[model samples]
Target: MKDKLARNISIYRKEQGLTQEELAKLLGISFQAVSKWENAQTMPDITLLPALSTILEVSVDKLLGYVAQDKRITIYEDEYQTEDYYWGTEPNTACYQVLQLIPPTKPLKLLDIGCGEGKDAVFFARNGYEVDAFDVTNAGIEKTRRLADRTGVHVNVFKADLLEFRLDTHYDIIFSSGVLHYMKPEYRADIFDNYKRFTNENGMHVFNVFVNKPFIAPPPEKETNAYPWQSGQLLTYYHDWLIRDSAEIVFDCNSSGIPHQHAMTTMVAQKITTSP
Candidate 1:
């Protein structure tokens, strides 16, 4: 692990165009310490791993040279080729509730991850927020761009896979609807941590995930693209943040033209300060 960390630290630092002294200054440590870590003469404290990984734009697991097995991109691309809005055309109810909490007088920067058809992205742009939205498929991104143009709202749309997506700018509000649940368990927490890092102080994050419930069964055997979260797991990730709202509800979904019941965990949290 130490050897791997050393190799990754040197590799990532160079990849970011940061010198040893620059990296040490960012970490608030001495250059000697940075040199030692890369030389495998010493290791960073466990508590510093999160900050180190964040600075390097990677997960701690990746910093430790562990790779995540992600296989959802093909599934999403195939789905997008056949359907325009797999979720729906309208913004989810959670999005409306989150908008009400934002200050009406302020024009904040917003990011809509997994923004399909740009419904929520268009809604935010039309309401005076600067919006950037992205999805895994070109089809979804194209639809988002077209919707924004038709609505006379300005929204930047791009194609990105969430598993490999990196934030280039911090946002005041990051909205992701019905997206994180598809992630593998090991990758979900790291993604949320990254979201927190890319959110400015006092910024709010609003998202929803499928959670386990007696009444809501798993997807059919033929469905290989679903991952359900355990009840209350989402809230645990926001222990250091101010939880504005949280709820577990059963809802009906007809995104695929077949009606089904879904149990979901919805949450809105504000980052008041850096995590300890």
Candidate 2:
């Protein structure tokens, strides 16, 4: 919470065009105090929260790393509202790899990051893995629940923004598909670290990211938040982990009814703990 508050203070303060000195002046404190708060060295007094939040134009909950609620946050929010599944209900081919690599001989916990419409989550749940899934869109969450209900499976689903959500619980597997690109490059390191830290020993992370290739044209849909990665960039973060599989592929997409090509990288990595 302290770390989140510190980061929020700095981020919001900068967004509001206020320097540390200016914020300190507004709060009737020394700039060093504001610096301390932003550096996570110390927290502000409870009494000063209101003024600070007001100045930063952010909710107190947000500053403390608690998301108030998800709104119409994604480009796909409206697309997910219809009776038909926008992305369809089929699980990605990569899901089968998960089943093969880490078959649930016993109960295993799996988390689906950005589980659009919950097809994969429900699939995992039906396959005997405990599944928890979240997406930024309310419609997506509803559709996911509907799919799970229709499939006679219970997929624990919720709504959360990828940028603000962090994992604090352990899981045997973490899976995400066609979503990591929505994460701003600046936050990838911290988010990946958080994901890696919370994974149980020998737990696997099956993830795919859209990567930039000179031959591939830009995606048809212009995303405000998309940052296509470079080749081999994702592997750098897993230097310590055993990389089970990694591949790059070029594929066609017709999401917005326009033909386009995308280069994507998929990686399956396992966290291994060695004896000292």
Candidate 3:
């Protein structure tokens, strides 16, 4: 564990172009302590694991260097491939509940960020919303376009990275599911800040994330050295935005045959208004 933690720390620190002293300062610990940890002479305490994970961009389990012996469930690769994961599944049922939250109004401008396979986008268009979806995969974009044509619904799907793409218009509802969770904690705040920028004053922002906590007794093993609260493709955290309009907890009592702990959550925040 000590050797693995040291290796992970050194690798990430090098990638970030940070020296040991710089890393120590960020962690607010002594240079000697950082050196000791990197040299395998000492280990970080458990209470400090989350902070260390945030600073190092690695998971707590990875910090301890314990690998999962069991196979993990693959969530989805991109928008198109996600169809199999949601169709006829309990997760899809939960997704329907979210879709129902959109008010029944014609020409409601909608931005489906990280729209996988255009399922939600197509659904929105069929239900009378002007849907524009964006995803990073070429395959997903083509497939979504084909689906829209076949269904006789007009959806503008773009094959581009949402992070780099600029939205030219404001939307009534800007929504994402299973997207924010995948972002590293270090970048999650920045992503939300950008969302706030793109949203209109009256627009609503809705998204899902894994809340911090483990599910069931004898918890599952970590998949990646990503973060303490999130595993591979699964992100869990509460909304940190200041102007939240509403929030809710939709527990997944039965998801994928495994008892999930703090696995399902939804939050809505509105762009705040100020006097002119």
Candidate 4:
């Protein structure tokens, strides 16, 4: 896996539109050091990780390249309620954050892969962007459609799996939230490859994935052993195909306020484009 220190510095610097000289002057490092760090010629020392994360407005875990995973350990009902109903959780917030990243409307084409119940789909549709939503589950499709109807939003919902799904066109913004991390990591390689192929050059692609956490089950834990264990789901790693903007997903299985609820990890990412 790639180290995130340099990447974090780069993202923060770009966000603030700070030049190397400016950031270096602030960090008390030479401009050459900033350039070398950004280029990955050398790394920031462990002592600097906290300062870097604070300057970047991201958590130290993210700056240190830590990714979180969801464990999906909640009881069936609470899990369903959290996944389909609550927008505060990471899985739901993942899409919401992506929506904020994109330039508003501007007649863009959008896609929501694995759009369970179309909650985010409806939100995007009502915001005046044309949207196409897809899900692998039949019930999810039906529920998405019902929700779309009730919301009086015009969103085209489809039923298909990533392996079998095809499109005759590309999208300005193609995104999948709360879906990719469920599969084993090997299964995700092809999906990332396809995502790059289907996005236009000037277009952007964004998605959320559960990240690997520090903990996992013991031996004989067949299902959970292979991946990072979060509340109850397996964690996976993902990165920018062309650029490197990444975020984390943490599923809170044992939430302080709610004992019976569980949710999936949510990590948000955006494609980076160079301005002309």
Best by lDDT: 2
Count of residue pairs whose backbone atoms collide, per candidate: 0, 0, 7, 10
lDDT tens digits by residue: candidate 2, 26-88: 999999999999889999999999999899887888777687452455689878878998888
For 124-203, candidate 4 gives per-residue lDDT tens digits of 88777789988655556676777778888888997655533445567777877656544444444545555656676566
lDDT of 1 by residue, 1-276 (tens): 777688678767875789999999999999999999998999999999999989988888878767522244535556666545655567778767867898547779999998977888888888888999988767778878877888899998877666556565799999988788657665567577878899999889998888888866654324455666888899998999999999888877765566788888889999998555
lDDT of 1 at 128: 85
Q: What TM-score against the true fold does each predicted structure earn?
A: 0.70, 0.87, 0.55, 0.53
Model 1, TM vs. native: 0.70
lDDT agreement of model 1 with the native: 0.79
Per-residue lDDT of 2 in model 3: 69
RMSD of each: 9.3, 3.1, 11.9, 16.7
Worst 10 residues of 4 by lDDT: 68-77
lDDT agreement with native, every candidate:
0.79, 0.89, 0.59, 0.59
- Model 4's lDDT to the true fold? 0.59
